[model samples]
Target: MADSLRESAVGQLLRLVNRQWLPYPDERPEFQLPDYDTPIDQEKPADHISSIGPDHQPKRRSEGEEQDVEAFQLAKTATAERTVSRTLTPIRTSDGIVLVDWYTLDDPENPHNWSSPKKLLVSFEICMYSFAVYFGSSVYTSSIDGIIERSGVGVVTASLGFALYVLAYGIGPMLWSPLSEIPSIGRNSIYIATFSIYVLLCIPEALVDNFAGLMVLRFLLGFFGSPCLATGAATFQDMYAMIKMPYLLAFWAGAVTLGPALAPVVAGFSVVAKSWHWFAWEMLWLSGPIWLLMLFLLPETSAPNILLRRARRLRYLTSKAQLKSQSEIDQAHMSAREVAFDALIKPWQINALDPAVLFSTVYTALVYGIFNSFFESFPLVYPIIYDFNLGESNSVFLSVIVALMIAMPTYCFYYYYWVEPKVAKHGFGPPEQRLIPALFACFLVPVGLFIFAWTTRSSVHWIVSIIGVLLDIPQFAASLFAANDFARSSVACGCILFAHPMFVSIGVPGGISLLGGLTILCAGGLYILYFFGANLRARSKFAAK
Candidate 1:
């Protein structure tokens, strides 16, 4: 009876809570005579309440009782488990900690409860938005040649425009993303700032006197467009339920990876056939309306931000009304300044301090490099090998996109129809299911490479070489899923860690910067994913690490 009671309490506290939730179990012991400046009396429900020991007798526990905790409060409390994801539960104590949740499955507030039409609407809009915003981030690279020709900059110096743009992505999100949680200013401000910055960066492309200025401006353009690129960064929280997010993230994962590959095609044409400045102006025009639409249509997805706004409204009306405080707001949240500072340092700190996290970051960074190589190798391949002009060579890169389009649906079908049920039944995450597609992809890589490398000749039909691109379609998508799934899994310890402001509580991963580099990186990363995934099913330590 005692064991069952304890189990019941634990199960309620842990499992019945939000899927995004988990508490960091504190390992430390509590101090004796714990300081308490104030105490409030509470009415205990006679039915649910019980006293430990015989006849409901109560006494102050002595030294020996400390270790075992004769009753509940007898043990020195190091930490109490609170729901991790920081969702706004309805119940609240004076200090604002929720003692128990009254809501869980199918809660209307949960993104999972959103209507299918709404979900699809948001997903489609976001996809287009991400496509346009990300295009600006990398398409600017296509104009590098025209800028170099016009400004007479050397080759190495000219490439900085491309390098700097990527660097902006690494830097800007760290600063601007936190403001996304501030009320009325949240994601709206982020979009405005990012676009404003991008517009400012465009000035150099329009009026620069030298290559250096053009390079600097291009980098800045990417820096500003960064927040825009990263805007969908939190969409997973808004569009899908906890369990549902893994499947959707696969497509999100693909879109982010595919963006860099596709950009060179657009930039290639604008630079080769027209002036360099056209690329900047056209991209800006294309994305301008989408950004404006986001201001009004982008709903508040961060639950804390929504709660902060709700609390303010409650205070406005009902002068005699009371609002409950949550435990997290009291303990984990900080002033605006501290949050900004912490957000800047958090990704790097988490990556460095956690070995598992560090491995995942490095692994994904390689994927980014591989994706970027399309820009590098496309120019090299068509012009050097096939004698195609700059514009013509750039179009060839589109072959990879054709492959991605075909493969994307295959992956979606596998996950929704075949894998989601298994993940639910086994407590396994999306990463474990990621292997089936990735194994197919890994085998395709060499075959594709052989075809692409050997068949681009007049003697061979052009279609023969194109088969390699076909193989890469699946390779790109599946490899992308492996890196993201593994990194996301590790970031939470092993499966899904508790959500804190500092970590992935919510976020996702990036793409190609080479063939050999990406291939080697993919091989190594996926190999790790395969081995760990296999062992994970049999071992509990690795399962919940």
Candidate 2:
């Protein structure tokens, strides 16, 4: 009885682990589940010739009847096409190894063919994961003063906790994203593994006594939690067709933006109630549950990885040694230099040399930098000018969230009405067509800056300055043109480093005016790029077709 119970417990544990962490076939109910009692298999090829039902199956006709014969031929051709669609077309290598792929376009094993509700469940989980990870970056900032007092560190030294964390996460994707792409490694494994470490590290971070230990811990936390920021979009691409991806990605951007926006307020309140250590404790509390949720529910989303596992199963079942996944086959031929070029050099190559890419990268980096600059500038503006407490000052960051809420639906409507029709008809217009909305929105950044610069005072209502901050929140280009998220984050890190000093030296108004002036210059540059971008793309080798 004891031996039987042990075996059963082990079997259940294996099944649970396989279901949660491993790549497996999706078995979700179809959008329109078929009735099993229907005589689907008995239906003949020419039965579909009728518009109504198989009851209208062609009756026997005389041999001389040419019209009926022609209809039958068309029906046969249609049936052949349907048969081909369901068939498994195997890839054979030079050495005769069979490369496995989806059994059909509509294969349940393929992530793309999963039912809508299943895909949505996975998408929301990843977005929530992104929220928890990004929420860590600013949660520390809520208690920077507490850090300064407890650790005997200067404000500059304490600020390194935030700065280093941001910088490390930006650098992390170069390592993590590529690893996740490997068929054996896969996205789900990387997410749960690294995030578990990140969650555990929070405990040490909260207990650390010195500035150096805390900074290192924060950096580690950011580095491990970095995968969901960039790779989460890749997962969406795996499940969603191009037509639907833009809308889903818009939600993803909102999730990422919402995290940092809400974190400060929560952390600020916690810090006031408890101590700075509570910020890390709160991070642990937030992330630990998210990790548990992901471990149980986040199935592996990488198609290549799914196929690789399927290939392994096929090898076992069929007793064939030659079965391999496309990814494994490619990996066999791919050299170190090719991997390096793709992972490292290519993002920078296009980013630096292609005029369109450079313009997009710079624009995104600048906007992201400005966004990060807020964490620094808000401390200067709200607390000093408005004389608000910590929680109240951080509450103003909710304006960013408000701006995102306003911008998302408006962009969705524009994409549906304006962009989708063009794409559906012409199959994507000139790249310049994408810049149309940006051309109008670019001016708003500086407008918001100048408004905030001029209006942030004792005489003005705080809402007016927040409105200025709200105006500064126009950034569609960041998501559309971000070639490399880490590179952009690194640029934003530099901006974070620069912002506090600039705001301190120049005062809030002067510093903001300077930022506004710089954005105006960027707007002028964007105008030139919008009109002349094709000429620049014509000259470049690396521009996306």
Winning model by lDDT? 2
Which tens-of-lDDT digit does each residue in 212-278 have in candidate 2? 8888898899899898875888989887767677798888888877787789989888799998898
TM-score for candidate 2 = 0.83
Measured with C-alpha atoms, the lDDT of residue 232 in candidate 2 is 86
- Quantify how close model 2 is to the true structure by its C-alpha RMSD in Å: 9.9
Q: Which stretches of candidate 1 lie over 4 Å from their true place?
A: 1-112, 178-185, 199-204, 207-209, 228-233, 320-328, 331-346, 429-433, 456-461, 477-521, 533-545
Model 2 Cα shift for residue 171 (angstroms): 0.3
Which of the numbered candidates is closest to the native, going by highest TM-score?
2
Write model 1 residue lDDT over 158-239, tens digit each, in one string: 5566666666555556555656655445564466556655655565566666766666776677667656445464765654
**lDDT score for candidate 1 against the true structure:** 0.50
